[model samples]
Target: MRILWTTLLMACAAACTQPANKSVPETIEPDEAHIALAETLTPADPTLAPIYDRSCRACHALDGLGAPLTGHAAAWAPRLEERGMEGLLGSIHAGRGAMPSMGYCADCTDDNFRALIEFMSTEGQS
Candidate 1:
C-alpha cells in the first residue's frame, strides 16, 4: 500500500512538473515593417497623436518625458539597441516602470506598440 501511494505521488508530481507544449499557445512576432513606419511619421496617422496625447503623455510626458524625458538618448538607447525591436514591443505591451499594461492605450495593436516605441526611440540621440 505504501509503494502504491508513493507511485501515485510520483505520478502526480510528474504531471504537475511537466512543461507545457512549446506551441501550446499563440506567439507574437514583432513586424519590422511596423517599426519602419514610425521613422517616417506623419500627423495623418490619427492613432499616433491621440495615443500619445490621451495616454502616454501623462506619464511619459508630452515630449516622452512624463515619467522621464525622451530627450536623454542614453536612457533609451541601450534598451533599444540591446533588447532590439521585439523586446521593446514586449515591454510596452507588457508595461514597465510606473507604466501600466498597454500604456492605457486600450486599442493598442502590435503595430501600434511597435510604432510608439519606434517613435520614442527615433528621436533619441542614439
Candidate 2:
C-alpha cells in the first residue's frame, strides 16, 4: 500500500511538471531586402515619431534581434494572430522575449502604444 501511494504521488508529480504545449510559429527569416525596408518604416503621425524613435526603432529595425522588424508583415502576422492587439499591449506592458517593459517608453500612453503598433505593423506591407 505504501509503495502504491508513492508510485501514485510520483506519477502525479511528473504530470504536473510536464511542459505546456509550445505553439509558437516559425519566424520568417529576415532578408536583406526586409532589413533595408525596415529602416524606412517610420510612423507617419508626427506625434508618434518621437516615441517610436526613442523606444522601438533600435531593435525593430535590425534583424536577428528577436524583435519583429518594423514593417515586416510576415514577421508580425503570426504574432498578431496569436496575441491580438490587447495581448501585444500586455506583452509590451510586461515585457516579453527580448523586449523591455512598456517597450522602454516611460511616459507613453496607451494610445501611443496602439499607434506605434499600427505604424510598425502596416508600413512594411509589400
Candidate 3:
C-alpha cells in the first residue's frame, strides 16, 4: 500500500515537471522570423517615406516596443479587424497604449495620417 502510494506520488511529480505543450494554433500567424524581418522594412511609397521616418518608424518598424511591427500582416490584420480604420485613426489622434497622440507627427494632417497608416499596414505585400 505504501509502495503504491509512493509510485503514484512519483508519477504526479514527473507529470508536473514536464514541459508544457505549446500546441500550434489552427491559424498560424506570422512567426518571429517574419516579424524580425518586417522590422527592417519601411513603406515603399515616396510620399509616405518622410512621414514614416519622422513618426511611425521608431515604434512600428522596430522591436522591443509595444507598437506592432510593420509589414507583418498577421499582426496588423487582427488590429485592423478589432479597430477599424476609423478606430485606428481615433487611436492615433488620441494615442493608444505606448503610442502618443498623432504618433508624434506634429505637422501631419489627417490625410497624411491615413496614408501613413495604409503604407505601414501594407508594407510587405505585392
Best by lDDT: 2
The models' CA-based lDDT, in order, is: 0.52, 0.74, 0.65
Question: In model 2, how large is the Cα lDDT of residue 51?
Answer: 84
List, residue by residue over 91-123, the lDDT tens digit for candidate 2: 899999888898989899998988888778763
Q: Could you tell me how far off, in angstroms, the CA of residue 72 lies in candidate 3 after the best superposition?
A: 0.7
> Lowest lDDT 10-mer window, candidate 1?
21-30
RMSD of each: 17.1, 13.5, 14.3
Q: Which candidate is the best by TM-score?
A: 2
Model 3's TM-score against the true structure: 0.68
Candidate 3 lDDT at 38 equals 63
Query: Which of the predicted structures, 1 or 3, would earn the higher lDDT when compared with the native?
Result: 3
Assess every candidate by TM-score: 0.54, 0.77, 0.68
User: Candidate 1: where are CA atoms >4 Å away?
Assistant: 1-44, 62-68, 124-126
Q: How close is candidate 1 to the true structure, as a TM-score?
A: 0.54
| Candidate 3, pairs of clashing residues | none
